[model samples]
Target: MIGARLDAVSEIAESMQTHRTSHASVLEMEGADVTSSQTEIHHIIVSVLSTIGRSPDIQRGLTRIFHRKATAAEFIAVIQAILIAAKQLQQLCIIEDKSTNQQRETLHSVLLRKLISIASSSTVINGAAKLLSALNKEAADRQDLHNLFIISDGKFPEVAEGTRRVELANEKLDSLIVVHRKQLRIHKLEYTSVAGITHLIELPLNTKVPPDWVKVNSTKKAIRYHSPEVLVALDELALANEQLTVVCQATWNSFLTGFGGYFAEFQAVVQALASLDCLNSLAILSRNKNYVRPLFVEDDEAVQIHICSGRHPVLEAVLQDNFVPNDTDLHAEREYCQIVTGPNMGGKSCYIRQVALIALMAQVGSFVPAISAKLHVLDGIYTRMGASDSIQQGRSTFLEELSEASDILKKCSANSLVILDELGRGTSTHDGVAIAYATLQYLLEHKKCMVLFVSHYPEIVSIKNKFPGSVGPYHVSYLTSQRDVNGDFKSNEKMDHISSEDITYLYKLAPGVSGRSFGFKVAQLAQLPVACIQRAIEIAAKLEAAVCNYTEQQIRRSCSLSHRQDGCKNEPTEDVLESDSLSSGRVEGLDDISELYRELFLNLNFGFLEEHGDDRRLQFLMQARNLAAQLIKLWSSGKSTTRDLWVGHTSWFEL
Candidate 1:
């Protein structure tokens, strides 16, 4: 029977079309392919229920009601027995698919009623009272009839409690057995229980015995005789016992008929119990994991995901306290788009995935792995993270990336969360950067959604310049400074080893673009050939220098535009002196505003110069000092006021 039910359910599930937002009717997860063991469980339940239907032990008990033949205690016992036997488990395939909160609460109320009926002497607990009331009515009617039969031990039997009849004929028969015992001067007078007769065993020949007694068995030293009078008593006892049993069966049959009305409530109580079990497990898990409940924003509120120190759930479980937590603040306004870049193995992927997982957890009504989180309901969470291609379906890595990206672009809205990692990475660097930049620009302008785009391509940071208000740059930080292990691995040596400089991963997320991917160092650590590693490093240096030189040229050309628009009288200095330009004394006629700005700039520039050991940035600082002087000279010479000069500034940093 259960197999047939499973087949029917499976067929219906297969025919239904799956939707992203479909509720799957009680979380059946119908088409998700439940395990074979669950199917076997259904079969076992069917067998158990079938055995219950065939059991004769409960047949009379279920049919009979607790009349005056039993006390209130026995009545409660009988009801409890029936409950234990009649109840069956509702199918629960998975934890997430249990009944709704409202349903469970309703069932909980029903269970409370059942408990009250069991505990209270009064039979008045809603649905439960109906059956008890019916039984009590019948019990009152049989109050006088109680004297018609008597239980032998005065209590219900642990196995089977049989009613004893008090008919006059039965009393007479019982008295006859006593008479036989006294009169038989036979060695032993015994009652044959199966034959329902009194017999005399080892009757003495010298003793006065009734000649009417018939010989039943003869032994060498003992003779057994059955009395005709005992046979008549046995027949009377059998008839009396049979008549009382008929009334007992009638009472049981009436009880079952009334019980049918409340059976549904009992089944509902079982379902509620299962739901409570799940809740208890969740409570225990929450306590152990230190998970906090997520706060969901109201429907009218803006879509936002603001998590404080949210850690990756899976990594936190595996690494425990070692996992570094990070904050994720996403809104449709300023924090709409973020470009995360970092060195290899710096936990960039982990950071973005943690945010996604937290969002997913919050939407599913589970506590997230965060100190605190407030999130708005999202339509969907779209991830174009890892490359999951299907070569069997003739799809390459790039094609798969494009397909997923295309879907995200087409369907994602402002309420959706988009996570992309290394988009266009399968292509050449030139084409890949262009594609990545365009995609970033499109998402910034059109999608206006919360996006975490992680990539090794530093050029993608250009979007932050374009949409500085919303798009931002972030990186998982690392301690690049070299450290020694017991002062081993000489500073000058270059052999691949697990040196701190080569393999230190901080797993910390910070604002701004990440540094180089450290691919060559990673390769060296992987034990690549020494000569090839050296050759790769030499080529990488040339390529980096060429790109830096080109970028610097573009910046220099752009600075002229700033100089022209800043209202400087004389042509701006062609370049700043690289060596000790700050050693010169402060220029006169500079207002407090210009002087304060210059001081702050010098402090930042000098700090960079000392830390990076880069002379080029020092040169850039010199240029900035010269531009400040020019602006101050213009403000003092009456070409423009300090206010207009600062206001009409052409550089991006106009406050």
Candidate 2:
């Protein structure tokens, strides 16, 4: 029996390996667009069954299951029962895509039901249930029961159930009777008369079912009700010194049909699994690295890459009601760093983390939840953006931040992306600012790493001013004032309000810095005292004043320097020049006016007109008259018309 089991094991292994090899070939060609892993596993099971012969029992069961004769729930129960038997036989059962609704009837469910039903009925062989019932009891004085039928999947049912079944059996004759699968020892108890006992069933397979067979001695007495031919066959087989008996063609056929049905199911599953692009490829080259640079090619240089508006897949699934999608833009000019500032509950952390996770997912060969993207390739991503402590490692939250930040700074290169949120917040304000300042300078001067840093400190905004065009500052905007006619501010005070329900975030990214932290407001909303809010405001005011003073001093110094280098001048001066008469002749009314002016000047010279004043005065009067003539001419031909190019009219202003 052990040798037979070994042979079966070898056969199963070889079969699995062959199926796996073929699956690998298919997967290598499928690439990233493959179906999921569960689908692939289902495919493999179907394929394997196709290679093997289908059993008739399995066919019958499948026919019953598929035609809706059996409900899916009942079918699952039946399949579980067969698995229970096979377990007693030391067989393996792997069901993939079991819980899916797509396929109404699975092969394993169909096959197992048939086997269990057949094994329970009698052509000549005793039913496994009936046999176990008889064997579990003992005949105290008589030696009557002799025959045994053991059917098992090789696992044992729980002891409590088995004990109950044992107590239920009526056959008597034992100091010892049942052989427990777990203990591998026979149970010895008081014996009852075994004069009428003839059949035994042992179900040592699954933890649910009873033993399928019982040991029968040749010296035991036989009853007249036993079949003569079965007794003769057993005697002959027993004479041959064989520990295990062979099943006849009829029984073997039944098993093949039943088991083959399950095999077909297993094959279907395997084939389905193999059809998935990822799993198939994995089957072929299981050693390959898990890195995939997505096909997000940037079409236009000017288009800002929006990792569109997307939710983190894992986070979204977990936070079904509370999940809010965030957007990211990677513009070429704002390449390296993006400093994001926002009030509390504005989703700054979620935005940064979602972007990092999306990038990671893209590289890991999964579809990203984005409307569209033109992503640049990133080799690695480092994040020091969240707070967590490792007390076991004797590390505090600040220590963890320092460790993560140091690692990020040391390892990040031009292609790596880094995200740090409130980097120095766990420490003193001055120390945090100093560390953040030094970190920014190091990233700017030493490495061209892409960074998205979220912070409340206004000092990071100075990076945008000092390193012009290197950093882009984005502040999440909020409506400043909200009030009703009663002069009370509207607050999101309801504690029962979930993150998703009635939550409104402006979500727009604006330029410049946010003015205040609403920490005290949030505390008040959480039922804190008004004095606490006042104290918070006072502290905030002092900080704001200090920052304003520094900025003012810096502004004054720069303005004074600019003022020295002819920098007080605001507008350009233009020089006056005499007009060219020939150039001016093209004017419509001015042409006639110029001719009239010349005539007047000549008439004055020839004494055809009376001079109203001295010669110099006459010349000045003529010039004034010429100007008036020009003005009158201009008035006469005022507002020259304009025609479109389609009308084919050329104008003085035509290009």
Candidate 3:
């Protein structure tokens, strides 16, 4: 009966044709495939109402108010009447069905079972066991009266206080369980030809069976064997069941008629949920004082990200069970990509992910974890920091990293923010350096997106020199001291335990480069082999010396070539003489700017120098020396005015 009602609903839904939004259309398409599940509840309603029709009093009452015709409208009116009656009985809804394998039956059936159990304990009727006997006789004698009864007393059930029947119904519904089974069946088949060959064909439905069966059976035993009230309650339930059948039958026809109008809309909504295209379904959560996104003004200027004390909402939630989250600040005007360098487990990954999450919140149109936020909408956000690899896809970890990075490069625009963590670690040192360098250059020079790069490679620090003032470094602080294990000389381990005051995790943008990678302390914390760590340190020392030696060799060769040119006959004698005088009188070999310039251009003829160049460079150099002398004189004279003589101007060019 339930299956027939569902089929009818499916037909009605299929016949519905109307224009729908993208979201709505998808929902309807999904619903059409499984309209049976939704219609079952409604069908139960029709069945209940049909059972109610067995009582002459209810029939008379309904007929007086509803049209006499057995049309769809009359069916709905009757269903509504039953619903109203149920509502007045303090029940929200009802559904009945066969029991699942091990789980109880549908929500309504469980509720009916509970009600029957409770009613049997009442002390109201006489010879209650005989009540079922009489009802079964009546039902057999008059088929229409099988489950019908009239509540001449109109008394409501009595049980616990403040517990509405509707509330109980909802509770039972909440516990409704569905189980799925995991099973696979394989089939072999032969091809069939249209004209010549007669072939075997195999069709597989892959028909699913319950993975885990949930059957519904009361934990309750019939305790009213000798109680009269139990019989009275059984009689009431029997009558209620009769009314239930009539209601369900009527509901089925009503659903068939009206379902055509609403089924399409309902289906579209379901499909939308399945595809996760509800766009507005995602939620944003944060706990910070700064905004995570760019804000746009009415005039169209964008609001920059100025997150202070900001953190990743997901990370924070995870950490809440253990450690505290550090606060951070990211601003467009002051910071774009922050080169975060620190010891391992120093929170670099956490910081980068937090920024990405904040941006994600903004793109999806949600508030971020900050005190106050204004965001310019972003197109999309990309994150590439964590470890994920698929060997089945024929990609190594490094290859996968490069693939994701390449994809990001192709897709990210100026409005996107890219986060990279220890990129290029899957290759040789030189190759990794080259890749890291080129990747950063592309992000800065081409992509022009907001970026946060976390790396252990020190080579990236050279970027400050290449793109002066464009790059800045921030490091996590650790303790350092002067001590030796044997009390003879200073030990490197003294710097291992950095003081708390230094671990600002300050998240502040400051000038200068990160000090050093505290990998030793980190290794200690991780309990690495001490011998391996010492070997690594020894290798690192050798590598550093080799690099320095190579650099010095290049500088010495260049210096030799310059000196040979300096001693030529056409040399500027006066500038050379000045440099010699300064060198002779100065501390060590440090020369003032003018002296260095004189030494630099000693071979050039004075006439040629004047003809080819303006005096701005020469005058500026001379002025710099004069300012330095004045500063020294003031220090000796203990007078501030002596220094004031060269207040502003290009004097600001001092290193």
Q: Is candidate 2 or candidate 3 better by lDDT?
A: 2
Off by over 4 Å in 1: 1-277, 482-500, 545-655
lDDT of 2 by residue, 436-476 (tens): 87797788778767788888876556666566787887877
lDDT of 1: 0.58
Would you list the clashing residue pairs of candidate 1? 63-252, 63-253, 64-251, 64-252, 64-253, 65-251, 65-252
* Candidate lDDT values, in order: 0.58, 0.47, 0.44
Q: Give each model a TM-score.
A: 0.48, 0.42, 0.43
Q: Write model 3 residue lDDT over 1-655, tens digit each, in one string.
A: 2222223222222222111224345457754423333333333333333444443333333343233333333333433333333332222122333343343322233332333223222221122222222222343245442122222243211211112333444343222211001122322222222333222122233333243322222124311111122223345445555455555445434434443443333233223222221111221122122223334333254324556556567765666534344444443444556677765666778777876776666555444665444444455677777777899988899999999889988998776777888888888865776688788878877866677788777656555555554456665544444434454434453243221112223343343445465566666668889788777677766765664464344234223323344453442322433343333323223234343333323312221122123342343233235334534544467645433433432222221
Q: Which wins on TM-score, candidate 1 or candidate 2? A: 1
- What's the count of clashing pairs in each model shown? 7, 74, 52
User: In candidate 2, which residue ranges exceed 4 Å CA deviation?
Assistant: 1-242, 245-295, 298-305, 311-327, 331-334, 482-485, 488-504, 529-531, 538-655
Question: Which candidate should be chosen as best, given lDDT against the real structure?
Answer: 1
Give the distance in Å from residue 556's predicted Cα in candidate 3 to where it truly belongs: 8.7
Error of 3 at 591 (Å): 30
Instruction: State the lDDT of candidate 1 residue by residue for 379-449, as single tens digits.
Output: 88999888777999999999999898889999999889999999989899757777788887888789888
